[model samples]
Target: MDVSQVFDLNGKGAVEALALVEAALQEQRRDEEVKLWFKFDPPQPGGGETLFQPVGRRLRDAIKHGHAVRAMPAQGGGWIVRLAAKVR
Candidate 1:
C-alpha cells in the first residue's frame, strides 16, 4: 500500500523523526502496511542519510520482517521517509 499521508516534521530533528517512525511501527500489524513521510535534518543526501542512520537501521530490521523504506529529498529541506510492510 502507498502512503497517502505526508507528515510535515519540518522543524523536527532525527530523534523526533525516529520516534515518529517507532510510534507508527508499533501500531502496525501483520498483513498491514505503514508508510511514513517526514522531514529530517541536513537537506542534502549525505547529511540526510547520516541523520537517518539509526532510523535506517530500524527500518532495515523491519525489512527483514518483510517491510521496506525509502527516503527522498524535500523541496525546502530535510527528507521524506517512507516505510512500508506488505501483507504476506
Candidate 2:
C-alpha cells in the first residue's frame, strides 16, 4: 500500500511517522513483505493524547525478537495495530 493516504499529516512529520512504521516492521524479524496502517496524534500535548505512541525501546526489542505489528487508522484519530509472528 502507498500509505500516503493513511493520515492527513503532511511534510517532514509525515515522513518521520512513516519512517517509524518502517522501523517497526524491520524490528519484526527479517521479513521483506509486510503491511501496516495507523493514525497518530496531531501534535497536541495533553492527557487526551492520541492512542498511537512512538515505538519505545521495549516494544522495539519485542519486535526485534520476531513480532510483526500491523496497524490501521481507528476511530478518534487513533491507530489499531495487530501483533503477529514474523514470517522470516
Candidate 3:
C-alpha cells in the first residue's frame, strides 16, 4: 500500500520536526511503501547551526539507519522527505 501526508512545520522548530519524522517512519514501517513531506527547508542564512542542527541530525540518523530514504529540496522552502519502512 502507498501512503502520503504532509507535515507543515513552517514556524515550528527542530523538536516538532523530529517528532513528526519519527511518527512518519513508524507509520511507514507498517506498510510496504510510503511517501511523506516535511516543510522545514531551514538554513536561514546566518542562522545558528545549533538552532537547526537537531533537525538535520535527526534526518541524517534516519538515513544512516535505513529507516528513511532522503530529504529532497522542494520548490517551496521545505523538504520532500521520502521514507522507507523498516523490515521486520
Candidate 4:
C-alpha cells in the first residue's frame, strides 16, 4: 500500500497523527515485507514547531529492533524516513 493511504494527517492534530503512525506500524508487523515512509510537511514559518524530532526518535527506536528501515535528514531541510522489513 502507498504510504499516503496507510498514513494520513488530514486536519488531525499532531498527537493524533503520531498515534496513527504507531498503530499502523504495529499492524505492519504481521507482514514481514511491509515498508513505511513518513513525510511531514515543513511547519509554517513562525508557527510553533511540531515535536517531530522527539517523535521521529521514538519511532526510530521502536522499529530499530525489527526489520524496519529509516532515513536520516538530508541537506536543505528535506527529511525522508523509510521503514522496510523482509517478508517471509
RMSD of each: 4.9, 10.8, 3.8, 4.2
| lDDT at residue 67 of model 3 (Cα atoms) | 74
| 1-88: candidate 3 lDDT, tens digit per residue | 1227777766666676678767766666545555666665556768655324565577778789887787655555555666776567
Q: Score residue 45 of candidate 1 by CA lDDT.
A: 42
Worst lDDT run of 10 residues, candidate 2, spans 3-12
Question: Per-residue lDDT tens digits of candidate 2, residues 28-72?
Answer: 443344434455544466645332454333344445565645444
The C-alpha lDDT values of all candidates are 0.57, 0.47, 0.64, 0.55
Best by lDDT: 3
lDDT of 4 by residue, 1-88 (tens): 2342334344556678778767766666443344454545556688676546655765777667653576455232323445566466
Number of colliding residue pairs in model 2: 2
lDDT of 1 by residue, 1-88 (tens): 2454565554566688678777766665545444555444444545434445665676667666645566555544444445565555
Q: Candidate 3: where is the Cα deviation over 4 Å? A: 1-3, 41-53
Q: Quote the lDDT for 18 in model 1.
A: 73
- Model 3: weakest 10-residue lDDT segment is 47-56
TM-score of 1: 0.50
Weakest 10 consecutive residues of candidate 4 by summed lDDT: 1-10
